[model samples]
Target: MTSGPQHPTPDTHACSAHPADPSMAPAPDAERCAHGQAFEILSTCHEHIGERLGALEEVGRALRDAPELEQQHLATLGEVLAFLDTAIPIHSADEEQSLFPRLRALPTFAGAVGDTPMDCMEAEHIEHGDEKARLKAAIVTRDAGAVGRHAIALANAYRSHIAKEEEVLYPMARQLLTDPAAIADMTEEMRARRREAGLLKC
Candidate 1:
């Protein structure tokens, strides 16, 4: 990771506004898996998202005590906002458009679980979008108190959402979505999406 300016700039990379913090950088393996393996790419996204959620919580706590947005806080908040605006939508598409549909198509998927996990996951995605809108509004208004409140709320909700995917959905995906052709198609689709979004180098 490279250090960014004190103020946020519109950069292409998702975390381009942050300082050189190793913890805030995406996993190196994630870059390699970006265009190759669908499950690996999605799992790596979850890892990156988990890291950002932690950062969000930390910034929220700092904002609560600080009189105003400090330079570092501003940079961190910029990174978080950039991530929410960019990476999150792509990740959701990877799940909702690619993974979830395949999982739903599985013969074992319909009744194996009493309720549709995909429905729950999709609902939560919508809720997260709503929460993000609130957080962004607070940031725009320079309302430190509201920013802190909404940031923590978004982080907590995301953590729970990630937990459910990791604990329940992903495992099921790995087991049931086993056809090589299907996996290849999913990987290509994910790669195409990133390439089209200019997030992929190759």
Candidate 2:
């Protein structure tokens, strides 16, 4: 096994103030991946997801505080929805196909990580899809109460989900995927999946 970079501290991901423009939020600091570069990519994607969640929470707050909806609020809702529609399914594929399979193949990881956690994660992805549909319907109907409820639910769900990946999943990926060749294979497969999904340049 190749000795690679150490796992980062959890505090490295402190949440910043919600940005006025959700699309313009600064990305997570890119890390050098001595082993699996896919972990680095996944971490950065999590940061983007976190920013969107923050924006979702802000929208929920606005809907609660005001009696009438405004154009700006609707625009922000649309912007966030557009991003979630595009980015999330691809991110899920990155984990379900590329990351989890490799991790589960390792004997040490197989027993420790087991099927339960991964099964739960996949189930949560399905839950997210259901929630996204409800959120879109609420936005279309211009129902502030429903929108606020769904936004808060989505944000809370992802915040918890991402926390588990950062704290447990990514750290274990860094530790177990120590072969340079294995890491390279994982990286290539992840990139290929993204390109096939039209999420990245081929």
What TM-score would you give candidate 2 relative to the actual structure? 0.77
Quantify all predictions' global Cα lDDT against the true fold.
0.74, 0.70
Model 1 C-alpha lDDT per residue in residues 31-135, reported as the tens digit of each score: 665655988788777777777888899999988876776679778989988877788888889898999788767655556463567777788899999999998
Q: For residues 13-42, what per-residue lDDT tens digits would candidate 2 score against the true structure?
A: 212222233232345543322223777767
> Would you give me the overall lDDT of model 2?
0.70
Best by TM-score: 1
